[model samples]
Target: MGAVATPLLAEERVVTLNRIVAVVNDQVLTQNELKNELFAVRQQLRQQGIRPPSEEVLRKQVLERLITTQIQLQQAALLGIVVDEETLNNTIKNIAAQNNLTLAEFRDVLQRDGFKFPLFREDIRKEIIIRRLRQRQVESRISVTAQEIDDFIATQKAQGNINSDYHLGHILVSLPDEATPAQIKAAKNRALAILQELKSGADFKQTAIARSDGRQALQGGDLGWRKSGELPTLFADVVMNMKVGDVSEPIRSASGFHIVTLFDFRDSERHIIRQVQARHILIKEEADDEVKPEAQLKEIRDHLLSGGDFATLAKRFSDDIGSAQNGGDLGWVSHGVMVKPFEEVIFNLRDGEISAPFETQFGWHIAQVLAHRDFDNTEEHNNTRARDLIFQRKSEEEYLSWLRKIRDEAYVEYRLDD
Candidate 1:
């Protein structure tokens, strides 16, 4: 009792190389904790004209991101969002699979880069918490009206842009910031030549596969489908209004330049008429070798066809809680509010009728057409939808602002002195 071992002495007595840098409430952020994030930030800066900050600046940024994360994570906890251990492990495995590596191999690579496995696990855990919290706070509250989407399209038309931008793939011949004037000129010339070849009937994707410098160049310049606001202003402006098979004139930007071709567009064809409102009950197919959502839905369909109560059974069997609690009511979703496959079947059904089992991204759904009013230029309905649209957009803006404020107010300390 008289001789007490100090923590400094105890640490020295053990084989400890990493040091704890910050204590966020009950959580500990260690030196090796932020190594991967710091490395990523450094790499991103180098890709731009920005040089890597000193060890001091990188440390500060890493700690700030972590602290911001911690505060949000705590908020998520307050909202009852907790990432289960199994979820964390599954997320890691999924990430590893996405990178075309086994989980063990991914873990090995992370360890080689000075990142501790537990620290990475905690980072992933925090991300899961943040997402789960947002799903409740934001996604559950998210609602889009048919008028909102239509007005958005109308605005696009007013701007002389494509009302819907297709999945336009591009190959960038960017001049790296450190490139010499000669190198820059050569890159620009290479871009101009690519444009010439494209105009002269060369396969744009083939040339992109051969010569583009952007990340998606290897995937034949495929950027996948994007909505109007999802792309850069200049390129998005040109591509949105162009028909399929249209190519842009050599487009120049700060990141060298690019040539774009709109090879495909998948505008959601299943928009609900503005006068319609709907809800649904879903019985998902279990994931077994022989069973599927369709099979389960078929049984439910028999019950409904026999005049079984829709609302009563919805409470008992529907998997979607957002709607199920209200007797499988989806409230009012405009046409594009649903996935195309589901909406397509629902749109064809008459009011008070039940849809056949339909497959969508979220298992199988058997929808009820509760109400639908014809929209043959109804002024009142249009105005209501317009208001709903504006409200939805305003909510999205408010949520983003809230997230940013949380980020800015966090108390962050760093290990720059080390």
Candidate 2:
């Protein structure tokens, strides 16, 4: 009887370790995995000084997050996306550096804080893979035309608060793509109800944790500081008029209804920088090439110094396809735009001087500085900012929509006991 009881206890332990909490597509999420994630999330909330929601609410939230993450991982695998060891190591090193610790020290700290190093590394790897997958699937497909940038900048100027930044808390009641009228109404009602709760002095972060469907819901829907140009168009229009600590009424969009609270605001500083008009001819090294790229670029530089036509030479020999057709003209570049070696060489050259051949990650180049100026780059900055903001907004919406589509198509089954 004692021997039989020992085996029964071992079997029970095995069952507990392998308990299926949920099934996401082809993957089974174990009880241990869910418990670990829950622990991590609770720790994160505590560190951020936000109160954790009730256990039931938090458990559901964490489970949903795990499901979405598993879906994304499955999609990433299907798309052949992977993070290599070197990149993962480098990313971890950078993270450690940001925290003012060496990699060894960071590992020790994580271990001391009850994190398993192997699991932490794998988590970082998965994050990188997901990021790359998003870049490929969603971000690469988003485009902002020149006209859109012009319109955005013009609108900002008209609004008279181009430099203002808003720190916002948001709650989203999401609707499906092609949602029925009934669904729309239901989502709107839910958003309005949430808004009423907020107005009645319910804690915003706590409510967001329990109810919002936005990506930042876990972080209490805190959409940290955003520039005026960075806000989604719907958010920008609504947020502009709200005072600090003021919550907007539910606003509707294609994705769904949104509720936003303005937590803080501040103005941004003006941008002024040195700009250079430059052009270059690149030569890439190939095994079949008769001449090395460095030697070829040296010859091209000599030709430019000896009264040769730079544009004609660039069109004929430059390997950079984007600039080659335009006479190799890289118009009005600022610092940090070009690769380090390329920028170093270009910025050091005087006006109308052709640089000697130099190698960057992109192979060998001979660059000529056509002109330089101390420019007030506010409009240009706004153009870039607008394009980036539009891209970010589109990416967020498209990603959420895509996630919903995939989730709906997935085979998910919950095994958690009621």
Candidate 3:
């Protein structure tokens, strides 16, 4: 028995291997996934009739995109952010509506385009989750203080750019990285020539397409509507000095030379703000209710006229549950927040005047205006716009930095190179 055991041999194991392009943290990205994504993206570009980059460029870009998406999705899962079925369905419906198609037709189109509807739905769900995760982590973290907004507004006012909206046209003569003096001069001369043509009543868009090297050259450099502090630094000050339909001289930046045309300008925030402190007792109609809602509202109104407490009556009878618990108090509401009919009545009402029972989309309503104030909200609007612009600017910067930080910190292994 011992001699027979000495002759025993070990069994050999065989393995099958598939190519992995990347290893991100604990997850691996397979070559098949990369190839499939690249194919889909190329198909999309072809459908749009846009020229795609070379195979090498496209592969690198697509792989980078996939890796970034994978990192964000992992973060989303760790943070418990999920796109539920109902929300995903609603988003799909909205997408269909935006493309002027019904749900059935949208599915049909997807099938015709060589996409599986289920996979598309999953992709949309993942995209939404990633978006929500980014907003939670990056965009929501940006804060613009009241003092910052005030300072921005004051600076714009000093620059004579307060509350201004400009319809802008731009032509950029771009320079490559690390350009020599001669190249810079040539770019500047090109910009100057374009400026001369623009000032001579030549079509700004046509000139932009034919000669401008701007990113929006394809769209004829139309930079639709922009508010003060929203323009690029090179043109911001120059544009403030220009009237509608005026073109500027060549302006130089690190990336390029610019020539801007002010197609239109307007004082967008010059409006009187009439705000009201009001309360309402809403009675939304119920389908099963036998009594007429209008008659019930009238009874409630009569009770109020007889010195019944508004808060108590609202708590007991008001159907607008949101304000009812707070004694039907709608606090100070500014213009454009309420329905048109509601606003019309509220603005016309004198302080302490209860409106007659009136029908709005939300059934019949009786309201009382506690106070009214009229003031110019132009500065306020400007401050809000400045805050928004600053927030947007900061968010973009922070988002890029955060993305880079995550990417750099991730434990990525390049298996494809091997």
Candidate 4:
């Protein structure tokens, strides 16, 4: 009430209108970032011909996705996860090549499309870092046992699902964010009802158009020809069990309930490779020796062909200590196990015939094929395929669960309402 001078600070302060939409740990997501992401999302949806949910739904979904990305980036930074300049540049260049544009043209195109070049680089760098993080933290934890591989191979062979491709149809009954148990139950019931309709001779495509909440719903839910490791783990085992035109039971996921149909199937044949059993005498070059490695190997080959015992020469002169003691026996060499130069020469050799000395990175070698066979590697082939499939399936499952665990543990705050 004293008419003294009023505080002068109020007149000098300027307020900024830029809003923070979300808080991810110590990082704040501003309105500009949210708008940019929403714009990108809308463009993507339009390109995909997807009928996205309401604007509010789209905004919430996009915001949540951004939050997850932000949290991951923050975690990556804490762990010192980084993508080197060379790798990032190469990755970008490869992407440009894939899009049929040179790197300079790609930069121009991105700018023309309203994306800043620096921002795009950062996005790609983040992606590579996240992939590396997943490989280190998630994939490394997964293990495939010898017995597991054998069993998996046996099962796949029995089911004839190995080396098969599937054309699939999908239907999703999506639940709301933070869906309550009651809502989940309702979603499941809806999924079951749709499944029943599908089984009762309702046209699957027509039903999908009318009912599915999937992004591909308008396209009759058709997921065209996918091979092993190309599909999400949710569909791997289920699809294998399904006959063409058969619909699956509802499968639960973070988003919703999914129902899949096997629209078509086909078998892809495996390849057979020839193998050789061979022996070699390798002589490494000595810098101080008057005789060169090549000349030494040639002399050894001459002695062998002139009736010197192969085993005695190998033991006396061969540098391959492990095989030298065993008379230079390489056991059985497969198509790809040995170096190309060595393999090419050895593979062409007639049984019990010595070859002229040849050079490989490992030094000089003279070889003889003791035996060769037109081996049927179908079982081994299937086992390799099965091992990969099982590892991929298990790793994908573990990756998702690990991602969810990390996401849940992070501290997030919403400021959008304010």
Q: Cα RMSD to native, each candidate?
A: 14.1, 5.5, 11.1, 7.7
Cα RMSD for candidate 2? 5.5
Question: Model 4 residue 85 lDDT?
Answer: 100
Ranked candidates (TM-score, high to low): 2, 4, 3, 1
Per residue, candidate 2 scores C-alpha lDDT tens digits across 1-418 of 6556687798998897879999888789988888888888888898888998889888888898989999999999999998889999999999999999999999999999888899899989989988998898888998889898888778888998877889999999988788999999999999999999999999999899999988888899999998877677687888999999999999898889999999999988787999899999998888898889988888888777889999999999999999999999999999999989999998999999999888888888999999999889887787778888877878877887788888788999999772
The prediction achieving the highest lDDT against the true structure is 2
Evaluated against the true structure, the overall lDDT of model 1 is 0.69
For 381-401, candidate 1 gives per-residue lDDT tens digits of 434544544555455445544
Instruction: Arrange candidates by lDDT, descending.
Output: 2, 4, 3, 1
TM-score of each: 0.42, 0.77, 0.56, 0.68
Greater-lDDT candidate between 3 and 4: 4
How displaced is residue 18 in candidate 2, in Å? Answer: 3.9
Model 4: residues with Cα > 4 Å off, grouped in runs: 1-22, 29-64, 89-120, 167-179, 189-237, 241-249, 253-256, 301-315, 339-361, 366-374, 411-418
Which regions of candidate 2 fall more than 4 Å away from where they truly are? 1-5, 177-186, 274-334, 337-375
Candidate 1: regions farther than 4 A off: 1-32, 43-51, 112-115, 163-226, 231-396, 407-418
The models' CA-based lDDT, in order, is 0.69, 0.89, 0.79, 0.81
**Model 3: residues with Cα > 4 Å off, grouped in runs:** 1-19, 43-49, 160-293, 298-336, 339-378, 415-418
- Model 3 TM: 0.56
Alpha-carbon error at 408 in model 1, in Å? 5.6
